[model samples]
Target: MYSSPEQGGLLLSSLCLLSSLLLNTPLCYGGKILVYPVEGSHWVNMKVLIEELYDRGHNITVVRTSTSPYIAEKSPMYTSITIQNDIVFHDFFDSFIEMQIKAQREGASALTFLKLTKDFLSMIGEAHYLSCKVVSQMLDDKEQVKRLQEAEYDLLLTDPAITVGLVLARYLNLPVVLNVRWIASGEGHFAIAPSPLSYIPVSGSGFTDKMTFIQRIQNMLFKSIIMFQQNFVVGPIYEAMCTKYFKDGCDIISLLQEADIWLMRSDFVFDFPRPTMPNVVYIGGFQCKPAQPLPADLEEFVQGAGEHGVVIMSLGTLVNKLPADMTDQIASVFAKLPQKVIWRHLGKPPSTLGNNTLLVNWMPQKDLLGHPQTRAFVAHGGTNGIQEAIYHGTPVLGIPLFFDQYDNLLRLQERGAAKILELAKVNGPSFEQALNQVLTQTSYRENIQRLSSLHRDQPIKPMDSALFWLEYVIRHRGASHLRTSANRMPWYSYHSVDVFLLLLAAGGSVLLTTGLLIRFFWRTCQNSKNKIKKH
Candidate 1:
């Protein structure tokens, strides 16, 4: 293959470009990465992402708990560090679930804000303690820690909700990438992004961006309550863990601030306008894909609904086992609907399962939502479910249970893509009316489709964007340049309220001193005049 002068030059240039690409590309392509996802939906949500990374030639090792056992097929590049503490993890989650069920049974209205706040704090504290304990146990095995350190992972990817992930990152001295599965909560403000409470609603505030004056006031109050709760309940656990595991004088907050990137599982389309640092990437809909062909049975069921379409009723994994009464009420509503109903029920099947309804232990939620025949979804307003619904342009009938579900449902309602069905007020009639409204109203469909378009209007797929950032961090050794100065600043200093207060204090002092001097001079002149007149 002898080439002419120009051809030879072109070949040489091509070779040079190839060499540059290979040399300049991120080192993470074949690097080892550790992922520590929290239990339940967090693990489920992370599965696709981790698999994608593995497909891209990255070495991934996950730390799996018993409750969140890794069920995904493993390849040479993908491995996991299974921590067997099934008893402890199960007991903790079971107790928490029992408490939630008890609260729901007591009626949502019966649980006052204070009680809810207290319960929420208690749960947070308990979860944190348990997580810390798990990490401690993991580290207690000196050989395990030695093996991990020996591996020299390129980066640490973890769920920010799990403080143990943060602790592990510190222990390994690795660059961190936080993978949060929800909108920025109060804890997120401390760990990931700066979500000002003035406009940004707290996780459970149930207030939208378009708030009334009173609602904003309530939001601020809720923010204060959350701050107090975080400090009082969660702070001690984190501190103790850091003190015990990390070196002396290690500040957990400062350690967390070192996080190089945050991959939040939310998009602006579904969230209020809030400030985010460069490193905070929105990978919403990363798990969403075009509708896959449903299973034979599910396909048959959905296809049978010609005109009335189908409605998916699921309370997500956490609330799959609903109370009998609640399930019966839901079933009763489904009985009246002309549309076919597919409810994800795990507990005792409702006795009133209508002819049109299919009660299954699990449903292909994303596929169902994307189906042309899917009319609406009844969900617990979980982040995963909501994102899938929005991705598929399906309107929702949200039965928010607790936590961020309430806020998420409120946002969807404000966007006109969903309606709320309060648990306390959930009855056959109300459920039927809400379902009928969503199915009959063209606006709900139109609004959700609009949002879906906006969500999908990005230049690249969200998964690609996430992978690029993850690799970018590794290529650069860390994406510290993307971090904001805000994370380093104290909360008061970040808001600059301290500076404003100082200025206000100085101005007030100047005004007060001037007024006092003027009064003193006036009184002295009056006394002198009186003395002159007497003389």
Candidate 2:
């Protein structure tokens, strides 16, 4: 078909403009970054991150497994990919809810259902297997393979929950950056803990406690189990499966070892004397923002408390199932406190005798922390809670329940911003005493406010720093320079003591050989002397 002269001119002009942008500007569409989030809360943070990057003139793509009402209600500011393969946020959640209810009816609890869904995430090292599965499901998935093979992204950032991003990066030969919102579990040996406290057992002994002989033995067994599972069992099985299906060589740990950077959600102010690799960066509080206004009724209720304002109590997301006994203890303790307590009691309380205390199913934590009347926070010490409290300069009294909560509270105690009370010992008197101390004592509040000021006065916003590093990775073909020595070193070399023992064993072996040789020579000479005398 012959085109009009004007149409031909317009096409030529568009081509010229595209060529000019490529040749003249650093901003290009090809420097794409892919991010994978774990679940609900993590997705919220990822949404903020992607928006910032999108504003910075980069094409950003978010890959998520499920959607929540919380996320759906929020403004859709960025493009995302969900299981149904669409960017419609509401549609994704609608599909998810339907699938979830069906699965739930088939004898599945919420936790179990979520876990089962997460398991579908393919092991990154088993690229061959995943590729085969993809092909087997949809032989003519032109768009999917095209996206994979386009060589578009320079880096991949992902949460640990969906570690499949590691494989994606390996397949594409892109740099990987991990955004660790939660502390690494004791089970995973691949992650490097940037903070000293990150090494502490989440549920057990404090960092200061010495390990028992049995505990030491258990530690060894645990490490051995991890090695066996990752290297020999799960890893090899996945690799072989991949090979059988897709005929591609896949090695998960090798792929993980290739990650260029680990950006931790921690800061020196919160995590002191942390051991970090050269490549690991503390970008905690990144994208942390203050909460909006509280409900009018809650605000007035808090304001009416005057000098003895409301203390916020929350057990965080996971440990909402407080036992009746524990709830009674909390209720009794709050009844005695001079301050009004706003407890986020997820279930029915054991007893209700306090006129001063209020129980609610949900509370705006950041809003409460930032409120002028907020005195102190009684919490389970989730990383998010700590950050929000510290960010708002409110002191906290942490009643840690499980998994990293103790360690998190301990760190807060060290900072003089929070106090830790073992749940076993959190009775009425002890709780009241701790609450009184934090409310009356100037030191805790003073220290916390001071740290908050320092946090606020940082050179740049945390999100901006994160965005800069993220975009920089895409621009520079990934931050390969940020990778650590641990990635390159052998397992034995990683432990200096092992090398020392190896040298000591070699020296002992040499000395023993020399002594045996000397004894043999001496015996032979004596035998010769005896034979001469007999002659």
Best by TM-score: 1
**CA-lDDT, candidates in order:** 0.80, 0.65
Off by over 4 Å in 1: 1-28, 66-77, 86-95, 101-111, 181-192, 490-535
**Candidate 2's residue-wise lDDT over 137-165, tens digit each?**
33235576476567366677877543456
Alpha carbon RMSD to native, model 2 = 11.7
Model 1, position 149, has a per-residue lDDT of 97
Instruction: Provide the clashing-pair count of each candidate structure.
Output: 0, 2
Model 1 lDDT per residue over 1-535, tens place:
7468899889999999999999986555577899887767877788788878988888899887655433443446468787766534445555665676667656656345467667767776777777777788888999999999999899999887765687888888889888875422353653556665667776677887667889888888887776676567777777787778766745446666788888888888998888777777888889999999999988998989889899998887665476778789889889888999998888787899899999888788888999999999999888898999989999999987777787888888999999998777777888888889999999999999999999999999989989988888788778888777876677799778999999999999999999999999999999999999999
Estimate candidate 1's RMSD in Å: 4.4
Best by lDDT: 1
TM-score of each: 0.87, 0.69
Locate the minimum summed-lDDT window of 10 residues in model 1.
Answer: 181-190
Model 2 alpha-carbon drift over 4 Å, by segment: 1-31, 66-75, 84-143, 147-151, 181-205, 209-252, 290-292, 349-353, 425-430, 453-457, 493-535
